[model samples]
Target: MCSGIRTNLHFPTCWDGKNLDSPDHQSHIAYPTAGPATFDTDGGACPSTHPVKIPQLMFEVVWDTTQFNDKNLWPEDGSQPFVFSMGDTTGYGQHGDYVFGWQGTALQTAMDNACFGATCKGLTTQTTATANKCSVPKTVNENEDGWITKLPGTEA
Candidate 1:
């Protein structure tokens, strides 16, 4: 149960108020401050004129990997599975960043239920009462598909 699988989420901080995205797709906006500290309740602003400030989002979820390493669960790519990914090159940074967003009210409730969801049985035992509150994310990592990208000749 000590196996470590961590998800580090980084979001954007500043917007120029005009561009839907930047030239590099990353630079048009900026981080008011470096890293996750931008999310701090006590943190400052991104120069009043920027118009839209998407207070950075920072969070990490670490799941135990006792099962991820199991030999019986090899992934479909015929490659070592990926537990998480950032700025996947194939997508060219499309999946890498976020700017201004908040975890909506339903998100917390949904996460709680997903993490601690009880086994659903016949109608005798189901999550009907709280179904609305507990969202089933469009994508869930039901499989141990952990991918680690490294330059050639580099050990993962």
Candidate 2:
């Protein structure tokens, strides 16, 4: 009920599903249409040729205004990027170095209790990293800034 600022993210409509990531990265997937915009997720297949229909991945990132304001975070200059990205070749095409580190409680509780939507309510903070099959170094990205100094809850 206390969600503040927010943003919406929509993944590519078509997916190859074979590569977790690609080198050139552009050739492995495709979008069959072009327009000002029309995201057709009407339970349709990818294409007649390569049939892989992925359930649309929609991400709505809800942020707390108290901590996420432009001044507290980063202000808009004429050319300063409000955000920095390491991956995604097709996006801003900003291929460069990025800092990777944990910012909050232990990596264990984050791995075990991470959820998408309504399930994330009434959560507790943990203070240690528990390394197991569920808690690997590479799995940390799934945590998605879990170290931030705020709890995760968005208006549904």
Candidate 3:
């Protein structure tokens, strides 16, 4: 059986105090750096350049690869047998980026209230079924489902 894998991502929690966005999209935000141990472990202050403190966003994802543990599925060379959606086979190139989608001052209000979990003041919580009903316009027009011949752009 596959041992499975889990990945955790922490977003930048400091803002530039001016523009909401940067040209390349990530320059406006930075991670904390105060404690001596490490930048991420400290929960320290924002750098001088990015002084405005923002909510720290974190995501954790778990994958079940047990179905692929069969020896018949392994390549003769013994290389990895899985690939990420973006065509990353080695998995080291995995990265995440997203634009803030909170409505108006809703996010600000939550931050102001020091909200944790679903009990924050002035914040509304929804069940997973309700939240899953929401959808955004597709940025890329491509078929990303089913057992396709190959990943979207990885065809040789």
Tell me, by TM-score, which candidate is best: 3
Instruction: Summarize candidate 3's per-residue lDDT along 1-156 as a digit string, tens digits.
Output: 466766667778888999888898889888877522232464688889988877667765667777667866676798766777777776666567766799989988998899866678998988767966887999999875433446666645
Among the numbered candidates, top lDDT falls to 3
Q: Would you estimate the TM-scores of all the predictions?
A: 0.38, 0.31, 0.64
In order of listing, the candidates' clash counts read: 9, 0, 0
lDDT of 2 by residue, 102-156 (tens): 4564334444565332344335433323322243357444655423433235233
Q: In candidate 3, which residue pairs clash?
A: none
Clashes in predicted model 1: 9
**Could you tell me which 10 consecutive residues in candidate 3 have the lowest summed lDDT?**
34-43
Find the 10 residues in a row with the least total lDDT in model 2.
80-89
List residue ranges in candidate 1 displaced over 4 A: 1-3, 38-43, 47-51, 55-63, 68-156
Query: TM-score-based ranking, best first?
Result: 3, 1, 2
| CA lDDT, candidate 1, residue 1 | 25
